[model samples]
Target: MLKRLLCLILLCAALPAAAWDNRGHRLTGELAHDRLQASDPAAVQAIVAIMARHPDKARFDRNLAGLTGEARTRRLFGLMARWPDDVRDTPADRPDWHYALKIVHGWTALDWYTAGKAEAQWAANLATARNAAAPPAQRAVALCWLLHIGGDMHQPLHRGHRLDGSWLKSDRAGTIAWVRRGPGLPPMELHQLWDKVFDPTGVDGGDENGDVTRLHAAFAPRAAAMVPDGGFVQWRDESEILARDSAYTGPALRATKAPAEAPPMTAAYMTMLRTIAERRVIAAGVRMGAALQGLR
Candidate 1:
């Protein structure tokens, strides 16, 4: 009886720490790497140089967080889906639930809400580049960052409200709760499943033994195939199609159904989350390219 009780306690303790690790930051790095690989060699070099100069991983993550559109949604969905059951139940109010779903999920909603602002920003950038006769390289870099960040902002999890332990709060924000073992699952669980639908290998990174360049190079063809010679508008259209067909459709359908029990956050879910993070990174790359093209 003591052994069983100890095991239970151990499992319970392990839950929160596991939850803290599931965020878009991990995936964004891989996505950025993938985008650079798919890009023109010169562009890739330029981005790398810029990244090296910046040195602030948090800034990079924050920049990625600002992205919008389907790319953001898809990535967030991936992260949420793979979030550990224990972490998913962790509330935003709890400091230990550091990666609690609040900021990430809230950012997702905010992405939708502020999409127009993003569009306007793109337009303004384009105008500035055109009128000021900015160098193509400068214009391109700006455009790339814009697209990347916009996609980040669009992720639903990023837009989630921080539930400060308010009982009346409609949105759970960053709160941990018990996974009810029953036929009807909670909204949090539903949200989690939707986040993990993408394949992790598709995005890139995660393997210490893996060659990022090779991995990114391998996926370049698919990302490039999605791009037309003309540029960003085509990329935007492709992203929209992905959003409508893949990101929104799968989750919307699954969310309608109830789970028998709150699913445990498993390795499989982590894998799935990793995959979505990679894709979001890829989507940001594509969007960045598109934003630049619009400037031209």
Candidate 2:
């Protein structure tokens, strides 16, 4: 019995990590785009150079592996909610570039509630790291990952609630839930609405051509409009409210009568989801650029 229990404990421990693997690909793609648009040209150049250095897909995967959970999640979400300060003072010692990368990566994952505190800490750490300075190559890699993660954190679904139907549990009101059931099923509450049911239909699928890019272009403007113009506290409050109201509607919660599972796929829903995702991706890029610029 003890051995069986230990095995069960180990299996439970591995679940989060396993879940992370499924989502990490999209997250990494988002961060890479964010880093390329950093306000600091030197920083952008530095990041790109680093990415060029290790063309190995495995290294990129490994870097992403370190960016899951609450702390990092909070930081990434915060970047979207507000801008960074430009005040600068060189520090005496530089921390590990990898460490700094992780810090920034995590910071980008922040949401509205944790944004204020996390932003402050990120500023301090960034200053210290800047003072310790890396060659253009390493800095570039760090910056890119930071930007990518920041974008990932902002997708309404990414900053979901914990208890009332968020990613961790299967209440089906966030990205995790939507992803589990591709399309065509009854929507999983607000998340499905946001992810796949909010928009008009007929825009769902495309040939393998440049459909993704075209989709990104379509929603960029709306997303840019959604970027909040306020302080971290304000953003956090807004995020909290959004999570409570939209993602966890009372009517939706009461409707659940069985164990959770993915919904069926439908062309109409897929089209709606694509539109929503396009808007989110564009907004993420614009907001990340604004945050890096330290603009209000």
Best by TM-score: 2
Q: What digit string (tens of lDDT, one per residue) describes model 2 on residues 1-296? A: 43233223322321110011112223323333443343444544433344444323344444335565432332232221211111112241111211101101112232222211233443443343243255444433334434433433343443443332122223322323332234444444334345333223322333311332344345434543554355433433343454444434433333332326444434554454445445445544554555444211
Location of the lowest summed lDDT over 10 successive residues in candidate 1: 97-106
User: Please, what are the lDDT tens digits per residue for candidate 1 over residues 1-296?
Assistant: 43233223322232212211223322433443344444544454443443333323343344348656534433332232222221234441222222212222212332222112334444554454344365554544343334333443334332232211221231332123222212343334423333332323322226421343354455445555555243434334444443334333322222322344334444544454446545544554454444333222
Task: Report lDDT per candidate.
Answer: 0.35, 0.34
**Against the true structure, what is each candidate's TM-score?**
0.36, 0.45
* C-alpha positional error of residue 133 in candidate 1 after TM-score superposition, expressed in Å: 9.0
- What stretches of model 2 exceed 4 Å from their correct place? 1-43, 54-132, 135-141, 162-209, 221-228, 231-236, 254-280, 294-296
Q: Of the candidates shown, which would achieve the greatest lDDT relative to the real structure?
A: 1
Model 1: how far residue 112 lies from native, Å: 11
Against the hidden true structure, what lDDT does model 2 obtain? 0.34
